[model samples]
Target chain A: MPPPAKIRIDLNSAVPAYRQIVDAVRVLLVEGALPPGSELPSVRRLAMDLGVHFNTVGEAYRELAAEGWLDLRHGRGATVIARGSPAARPEQLQEFRTRLRSLVAQMRSEGVAPARIAAELRSLTESLKP
Target chain B: MNSALFLSLLVVAFTGAFMLLVPHFSSPRYLFAVTVPAGFRASEPGRAAIRRYHWWVVRAIAASAVIVATMAQSWPDLAVVLAMLPAIAGVASFLRERSKLQGYAAPPPGVREADLAPDGDHLPRWIALALVPLALPLAAAAYLRAHWSEIPERFPVHWGAAGEPNRWAGKTPAAVYGPLLSGAGMMLFLLLLGLAIFYGSRRAPQRTAILKILVACVYFLGFIFTGVGLMPVVRVPIAAFLVATFLFAAAVIAWGYKIVTDPAQPVEATLDQYWYLGSIYCNPQDPAIFVQKRIGFGYTINFGNRMSWLLLGSFLAGMLGLVRVAR
Candidate 1:
């Protein structure tokens, strides 16, 4: 097996600490670096490692649990779960649409051509396929 | 003039002298335990800074030694404490450099992620058995039994700084054997503590040094404890004891320093901000019970780990028990 991948976050980043942890763990989960049934570090341990409050890690773990990526127990701690994809919802797509529009606008402002933007999106979608 | 005074002077002198070498105990390029990019610590300007630091430490040690030699006969206890100034100065330099190095060097590469694994690095389990000989204080106790008739009805159990026996204990078996028994108990306690530290450390180099020091201490303490316990009976000269103790200390420090600071074993760290005031390490993610000191030369307990606390508590209790037995 490959060496275990690590989740890291910048304490000095503009994003909130909890959000950084949530995002980092989500990326690890998506990339399958943290396999299903693998245990997450206890909230207190992660908080101490990140120099953040216990609630920050607890909140992040709760967020991941709500998103169906983890199972949190009162005493046993958090564990990854084999999460199937959520059903497509138009409301979620609307949120994605707004996010994409802002991203595309930012790229355009940076002088990226519309054709180049569309090509990059097509490549990302292709790469996502198994 | 007395055993207590000699012991005090030796402790202070040894501690202060060891303090002089503390800064050089870590990797020069990396900011000691934090492992930040200390480009300046290895640069021309950094060389000047290090030179100045060393110059001050030398002065502190020299002054402390002079004072210790002079006042040890008078105010022995105070002289011992005063002798700690050099080591204190060394720590001051370490912290000063840590702070200054932060500004002069780039910020630390923060929040490192390490693969959590149990890697035992080929150390044999039999190495721990080196502590077995710490039980030698018992032999001294046995000798006291053979010469039981020679023991006076009332003997000097404790002494003052003026070379006079101050506290007397009845020559019962309990009083006769107390110090040696305490020595045996203390050695046993320290052996357990050392083994815990050896197994608790994750870094291979640190573990190697911890093993050497712990094993070395087992033998060193065996002799020291047996000698100390036998001192009142055998009437050993204070000066001779001091010289032997100093040699043992020098050997232990030299050997440990050589191993732990071996350029081969550089300790790595991350999220140093959690290292409260750059001293106390509170990393819960780290599995090791003992970690290399971020600023000093030896092992420090991980305050975040519950097991570290338990170890500390038990060791302290053992120490108190040893003292009670000696008293």
Candidate 2:
């Protein structure tokens, strides 16, 4: 039997709950942790788990479905769907670089060394490999 | 001894017994469930505090039993009031124990963590079909129907301290069928409410425990209500029914406490800061209308939720109906 799909969210995080849901699920999808045909818990169930509003989870599911990573149908809950790789667009790449730079700067401000940051970045890249 | 005095003694004994179980329920094993880090259950302060709590409650219950059997008969009403002393003392002991456990500086990692709730269809398929309880009341009604011809025209509605019938009612359909219908209605209402609580609650052993207790209590109600329903026909002593009901209630409560505090079953009960007045659980962020009680071994309504207000309204309505029936 396939392993259960899992996602973790921090309620205390600065990020909004719905955004956290999207980020967490998208990572799982990209990592193939959630394969096509995987059934995500219903909005009510996930909302209950996360201790968030039902609409928050519903919005996240809708956003994922819009991104081609999930298929949401009435009464079926959400199902992961197959998505072909699409190279990062120019705007998306720019956005990633901006976020990466901001994160690195924040890490450096927190007294992290440049060498540690580079190594951490390399480790994250390595982890993405199948 | 008068029946009222005997009944009061029984109430005191049952209360004492229930108080004894509270310490175990409030123990770290059930409170934190498996959510706390390994070995925290064995922590010196927590274990010591729990042991202290158990010792206090046990002693209180023992003393209470002695007092009820001997001293209570002298002034049963006063004894009934005095009964609250041990129960109150037990609660104070538990609160102190709770304080000692909370004195641990480090919070459990799982305290902040959340469990993935089972699919919204978390209730067992069979629970949704829990129409079994309805049959108890119906069986009672059926029995009454069978003896319809010979049923008494006047029966005791209320019994006084001397065991003599004080209030009498003629065997109209209302008097005959009222208790049965109302009992059946009450049973059905409780079952539906239980279903609501079962599904509205998140993942935790207490969730199942609450449902089981609810089911068990309903069956007990079936006995009480059916007995009361046949009051006109069954000339059995009112004291007998009251005694039996109280005994059954005590047993059910004890059984429920055991289920609630089972060490083998780890729970994912979340302790929130929103527990208003230290008893009512209130969490605005939680979509669940019900959550496991932090101070006790059962579910409490989240006053923060809008649905909780509706539940309170319905509960009040039910209580009013019960009051009318009692009258």
lDDT for A50 in candidate 2 is 65
lDDT of each residue in B1-327, candidate 1, tens digit only:
565456666666677667657666665535533444545566775676577777777888878777877887878767767878787777777677667655555565544343322234346676767757755776788888888888778867655554566778887877888877877786677667766766666434566666667767777778777876676578776556568878987877677667655667655554566576566888675555777675545678888878889888988888988888877
lDDT (CA) for every model shown? Answer: 0.70, 0.70
TM-score of model 2 vs. true structure? 0.80
Model 1 segments beyond 4 Å from truth?
A104-130, B1-17, B27-37, B64-85, B88-110, B114-169, B180-292, B299-322
Residue B179 of model 1: what lDDT? 75
Output the number of the DockQ-best candidate: 2
Show pairs that collide, candidate 2: none
Q: Give the alpha carbon lDDT tens digit for every residue of A58-126 in model 1.
A: 999999999999999897778899999888699999999999999999999999999999999998776
Please tell me what DockQ candidate 1 reaches. Answer: 0.14
* Listed models, DockQ each: 0.14, 0.37
For model 2 chain B, the run of ten residues with the poorest summed lDDT? B109-118
Question: Per-residue CA lDDT of candidate 2, range B1-327, in tens?
Answer: 665457656666777766766645553533222223445657775577667876877787666656755755565556566656568777788667655554453443232233322354557665653567677768877888899988877778776544667788887777787777778767777787787787777655667667777777677778788788777777676777777877777676666667655657555445535544346667777788887665456777888889889988988898788667655
